[model samples]
Target: MFILLFSAVLAESLVEIVNSDPTSSWVAIDYPREVITLAKMRAMLGDETEVDGLETMEYVEPDGVPTSFDARQQWPGKLFAVRNQQSCGSCWAHATSEAVGDRFAIKGCSKGVLSVQDLVSCDKNDNGCNGGSGPRAMSYAQSRGITTETCLPYVSGNGRVPSCPSKCKNNSTITRYKTQNNPTFTVANVQQELMNNGPLYFRFTVYSDFMNYKSGVYQHKSGKQEGGHAVLLVGWGVENGVKYWLCQNSWGPSWGERGFFKILRGNNHCDSEKGFWAGSVKC
Candidate 1:
């Protein structure tokens, strides 16, 4: 009993065993929650970072936003509630849908939640739940258009990507949108876009240590490379002298900071200072 207890404690010190693989009996997390195994976790990252996103030359509404701001509290009624992506690597879908959904609200077009499952299942160019590209997902909305959450709710929570529905799952109203890249991807530009428009999309590198993140401004403390991930950056602020960018995760509200987390800002923290994109809801 003493030996077993010691082993358990040692394992936990390194990583949390959210779920165990039934057959392998491996201490690492299995499926449907958060993949703890390094390989599987890396596989979850589908963001194509090879493409050059480093560029800056555009307008900046300097007077539109304050130095420190949070869209959740400042804007209100323009954002959607936190959602759970389960074990599926559908972060791309969530980021794109949430950002575009916010545009709908900000534009006074619709207040309904956009269907992320629609993108996951239907966007054949990118893998369903396995992983996807944020920019591709945004362009999908632009060309093909997405539906309302009520129309085709998410059904990939079990880890496996579900088949695309022939039409809206239970409704008929399709919420379409079009996205354009933020050419001038700077901290100031990102903040101005968030305050003026809404959430924006970006692909950031995710390390294994991120799984254990509880709170505080997160930096790549310690852990092997997991892979690139996509998230909807909502706001930015300074906490206890730590400057951070606020982001809404698709890992459900039970995870980090009520489904949100603040990461280190400036100097392209987590590569968020690049590969940024945002769009509007096409009525």
Candidate 2:
């Protein structure tokens, strides 16, 4: 029953991304204006409907200046990285793998990497290689368990299910602390939480143009109506006098300036109010 629902959602999301036009051609707006409009839209939409478990926090005004310090500081010494969903609809796998990796790190383990391949191939309870719920995936890990990356290294391929490695070790170190679904989580609260916690998992409506967003503030382009569903959060940092949130992207190191981007913090686009942003295990 869950598998069927997951497949349906995955199919619908893929169609949205494939059919929507790119937003890169749209005119660039000042960072402050874009942030304000997005914040307003998020507020009007409300936080309850935006995500599953978003808790309200204090609000802060958007400052166009990027902060100088690295936002990754929020999770000190934690080796957090984003996994690109690529052409596959396996965002659930990505989110699960990242959370597992972080949990392993929290246990004071040096090589704290887990294989998405293990979950992709082993978990039959949910959709394989397609979108699945983060809580469901984590629950799957808790039940059957997972292995280290050295035991089952992930092949750099997407969309297709790769063959599982022969050796299977029953090693699972992930401990889920909190999970929330707030469709209306505000940006200020999200930023505050990320600053207080280690890392956050979020879902955004991605468009084709998002694939080409190299730098600078973004605004809606034609035909760009919520196309992508991803999991990422503020890493930490400051740039150009204004405080910026370090966005850990999964597109690989070559994709966007070493596989990351910076957005103005406290702004609507990166804040919790407009979208789903939830924190997880501390390292």
Candidate 3:
């Protein structure tokens, strides 16, 4: 015996939850509805132009075994997990800041875990924490430079600050080689980069159903399309002849079997046949 119920929220996101047992539960969402709702709100407030630059990158999978060449065998013992501004659309800052934090860890210094708050409040290129491109944010970091998390910490609540942090002590040990603004990167390239570098940043359209992703291989939910903002490429491997890329999510350890997801490696999803890769500087 199974039962399902559907309800809509104030945010216009339709939620469907299923009760399997006395205690077990599940949920499903109507992503398009949420997008439409957001769109309508923007239209009503004359904020349509604010979402103008947001673009959906084409999805491409990688080809072969991805490799990492960086000297750092694994991410810093103290990796900083970040929460992407989903409906708020600040993935660009989250992705860039997370990568920077990881790069700092590779420096073998104090394991600097920089704050995303700094990027969110300080960066001028993109709309604060709203959706922005990784390359663009990286370019901004290169030009103006980023401050340590110590000087400026992150604040989770909403509301904007009139002024930005003034601390300018540069303690990062990572260097950006070249950044590509392609819609997606190949898995082969990702894997190779992981073997060569340390970790990589990625963005994908997450379906609301993903919030309920428990375990096992994930397939797109039927009639569902909730695009997520940002994620991290941690590791990759072949499981029982099937290839998979281990993704580290920021939904906290309570979700998805310790906040981790395994995606079909090298599939058209976000262009990584080999695997998307990002490098870190060796200190």
Q: Can you give the TM-score per candidate against the true fold?
A: 0.79, 0.58, 0.63
* Best model number under lDDT: 1
lDDT of 1 by residue, 1-283 (tens): 6754653454355344322222211123222234233443444465654435465334233566665888778777878998877667888888888988888887777648988888888898888777887667777877787777888888876677778777665446454555543232455566766777778886788876676555677766445676778878888777777677788887667667777888877756566666577765444
Model 3 lDDT, full chain set? 0.47
Error of 1 at 81 (Å): 0.7
> In candidate 1, what residue range of length 10 has the lowest lDDT sum?
21-30
Cand. 1 TM to true fold? 0.79
- The per-prediction tally of clashing pairs is 0, 40, 50
Best by TM-score: 1
Per-residue lDDT for 77-97 in model 2, tens only? 665665544545555556556
- Rank by TM-score, highest first: 1, 3, 2
**Which of the predicted structures, 1 or 2, would earn the higher lDDT when compared with the native?**
1
Question: Which of the two candidates, 1 or 3, achieves a greater TM-score against the reference?
Answer: 1
- Each model's RMSD to truth, in Å? 7.4, 10.9, 8.5
- Candidate 2 lDDT at 197 equals 43
Candidate 1: segments with Cα more than 4 A from true spot: 1-11, 14-44, 49-65, 171-184
Global lDDT of each model?
0.69, 0.47, 0.47
